[model samples]
Target: MKALLLAGGLGTRLRPLTENLPKPMAPVGNRPWLEHLLLHLKREGIDEFVIAVKHYPEIIQNHLGDGSRFGVQIEYAIEQSLLGTAGAIKNAESLLSDRFLVVNADIIHEVSILPLVEYHIQHKGLVTIGLTEVEDPSHYGVVQQTDNGEIVRFVEKPKQDEAPSRRINAGIYVMEKEALQWIPKNKAVSIEKETFPLLIEKNVGVFGKIINGYWMDMGTNERYRKVHWDLLDRKCSFPLKEKEQGNGIWVGKDVQIGSGVLFLPPVLIGDQVHIGERSVIGPYAVIGDGCTIGKHVRCSETILWDDCKVHDSAQLSNCIFGYDLELGASHILYQAVMNRTAGVLQG
Candidate 1:
């Protein structure tokens, strides 16, 4: 099956991080966040892809070029202007098969696609939206489905008290070609707001398939940190490059650890990392490749991306450092989130 990946949003919620990189390009573990999605879909037996991109298309193009590295075939459909959800798919309509999968690129999920496709085939629906339950459905596109699995309507971000159901749209869908014609050409359209409503109005078959595993939208600071912790906690099936170094610690090559350094379990220090004596790290610390931790440093519940350098006596807790940022000596911080750029958030 051909899957259409919507990779072109402005990603304003992620702010400075998305200033230089696309939201889908955000790092999950050692690999790009979007790589997890592609590999997950590929594992479910979907190897063909149509990536619709608008912002920083080249980064995504250069990274996942031809999809050969991931054992898949990929085609690019670049949109000149901002096209909303449905419009992006409409823009790539020619590249898609008669029936295809449409997935939001910023999402991280492990829902099986083959089962959703099989459900769509059995129901014979023009569209089948993957739904997942959440405590607060008000912020998401709420879905109401009949007992027979037919989706009745879509209420986009309704008030919590007025919501019809807790099953919200998971941004994965099985859509048919017939649904594309309903969306106008060269115009911004939202699949949840416009296309699905119109498809329902026409009395066409629209269904819902409940997802059974992990799902998250990598769109904010907290969510970004959560994904990394989730990856470390073994919540998802993403592969890691580092090897286990015993005592709940994972390390990469050429790691230099000074004596008297205390590791508190569940820590991952990447390649070429240097930790000075008397430094305490972890119980949920992720030090990226080439990072330098000086003496008397304390780091926990933090994810430092590649090349971040922390000077002597620095303490970082509940923090995330972007690439190549520095924490001066004797500095202490908690709950600081720095974007993956020059913008440093310090105490």
Candidate 2:
């Protein structure tokens, strides 16, 4: 089966980071967020992919190319005009001729898709959507299903009291090719608001499969930070190298460690990083590639992206520093904004 990846959104919520890089290109650990999604999907035996591109399309195209590196054939569908979720899929209809999977590029989940595909085939449903229960359902498109798993209602971001169920849409679906007929071409349409409801009204079969696993929507700074922490803490599963238990801090290849360093473990230092001595690092920290760390710095529960430079005596806690930014000496940052750029002396 093929897959349609929704990559056209502007990602306005993840500003500063999304100011330059597309949401899909934003680094989750050391790699782009979309990289993890693609790797996961590829492992599931779904190789052919069609990515809908809009904002910073070239960056994704350049990085992923033809998907040969991941053993998949990738095609690009550029959206000249803005298309909503359903419209985006319709725009790529020519390429997705058979049963296919649809996923929001910004969502990260460990749930398996194979079962959902099997269920769709067995029931001969037009669409099979993945659903998961969330504590607070105010912000999500909620789904209400029958006892036998057929969806009875589809509501998009309903008021708390108007919600029929706490089972929110997981933004993952296995769609039949014929579902595209319900969506008009060259027009903006939402599956939740427009297409899915129409199907339910016509007695079409739309099934929901509930899943239990690690899932996250990395659309905000806070959630983005938490996603990284989850990966580092092994709360979620991903293909990342594990560090061997040892004394002092372990640094990766091409790393530059400066003098007077006080290092602590469970910390991961990526390739080509520069660390200044007398600086206390880690306990729970992840420093990305090519970062420059200054002297006497104290950091915990912080992640610095590639090429970020933190000067001497700087103290950072529970913060995320984006790429190519510079932090001056003695600066203290606590729960502040430092989105993707550099040269800040204070938090």
Candidate 3:
């Protein structure tokens, strides 16, 4: 089945980081965060994808290209204006055929999606939304379903006291082509606010498929860091290259380690990285590709993206540094997170 990835949001919560790059391109672990999503979908036999882009479209276009590297065929639907979730799908109507799956680019989940697709096909419902039980349903669009899994009510961000169920929308859906008829073209429309509710109003068939698994919305610095650690900690399942035992540490190809370095593990270093001497790394640190670390540095619980440079004696803990950034000597960056261009968080 073809998939539609919603990647147009401004990523306001991630600030400083999304200030330059799109949220989908934000670095997570060793590669672009969106790569993980694409890879996940690829494994599910959904190799054809259409990404809807608005913010910094060129950057996403340049990075993903035709998606050949990941063994998928990718097409882009550029929105000149900000189109809401349903609107974006409506805009890409010409490319979509039959039933399709829609996913949010910023969401990371390791749930088995095969069942959800099968459920949608079996019910032949107008739409089937993936639901997950959350402790706090007030912050999300809660779904109230019948015993047979048919959605009975659609509540969009109801108050905690007013919510009928704790099951919230997972921002993933399977919809028949006819569902697109409910959404208008060339206008801002939200599936949660406009389309889904309208379907319910018209007494159309809508169902919910609940899944229990590791899921996170990487829309903030803390969650972004947590997601990376979750992957490293084996809390979430994603396709990633594993490192085997090596001298003092496990480093990827083309790595440059300088002299006088004090290394520690459970650390994973990516390709084309440079590390300076007298530096202490890890006890859970992930350095991305093409990074340059200067002398006498200390990093723990930190992640650095490609081409990032840490100057002499800089200390980074519980932080994420974006691409091509340079840190000054003795720069102590804690809980610092960035998006595209360099912007430091004091906290």
TM-score top scorer: 1
Candidate 2 lDDT over 30-145, as tens digits, reads 77888888988888888899999988899999999999988899999999888899999999999995899999998878878888888899888899888889888889888888
lDDT score of residue 85 within candidate 2: 92
Candidate 1 vs candidate 2: the TM-score winner is 1
CA lDDT of each prediction against the hidden true structure: 0.87, 0.83, 0.83
**Leading candidate by lDDT:** 1
TM-score of predicted model 3? 0.92
Deviation in Å, model 2, residue 39 alpha carbon: 0.8
Q: Order of candidates by TM-score, top first?
A: 1, 2, 3
Worst 10 residues of 3 by lDDT: 338-347
Q: Over 4 Å off in model 3, which ranges? A: 158-162, 246-250, 343-347
